[model samples]
Target: MKNIIGAKLKAYRAKNGVSQFDLALKSKGKLSTSTTSTAETVTNYDPRLSTFIEMYRYVDTPFDELLTEMGYGESYQSTWYKRHKGNS
Candidate 1:
């Protein structure tokens, strides 16, 4: 799971042209360079929700979109989900 998130995070960084150090500084220590580096790595980088929020704000990307990229968002948009939502 961490690896999955890491790959997505890496893509965002590449798109934004921000380095690990830059992310750390921009986030004002909510994210560290080490954490950024790990999150961009190919393994072992499950970040906290706060990190997701921070990145979302920084890059103007939806937090749910990140989850979707990790294949965790479809259920919410699936037929079952639509039925469940209607019931609720």
Candidate 2:
């Protein structure tokens, strides 16, 4: 899951043509400086919900899009239904 979130963050940053440092700067004002720093600190960290929301605000991307872009397959809200759809 952390890897998925990291992949999404990296993809979004790439799509926007921004470096991690640039993202950190942008995120600082919208999210928290610590959150931004944590994101930039490693390549595989699960982002907090607030972090995703803040990133979406700054990048004009939806959380679902981000999740898809990161290869999450289904939205978090639909995970259980998606998982159990075939079983039921």
Whole-model Cα lDDT of every candidate shown, in order = 0.68, 0.61
List the candidate 2 regions with Cα displacement exceeding 4 Å. Answer: 2-30, 75-88
**Which regions in candidate 1 have their CA more than 4 angstroms from the true location?**
76-88
Number of the predicted model whose TM-score against the real structure is largest: 1
Clashing pairs in 2: none
> Candidate 2 on 1-88: residue-level lDDT in tens?
5444544555677788977667767766565546655665666767767766665565545655656666675645476766675584
For model 2, what is the alpha-carbon lDDT of residue 6? Answer: 46
Give candidates' CA RMSD values in order: 4.5, 6.3
Measured with C-alpha atoms, the lDDT of residue 24 in candidate 1 is 82
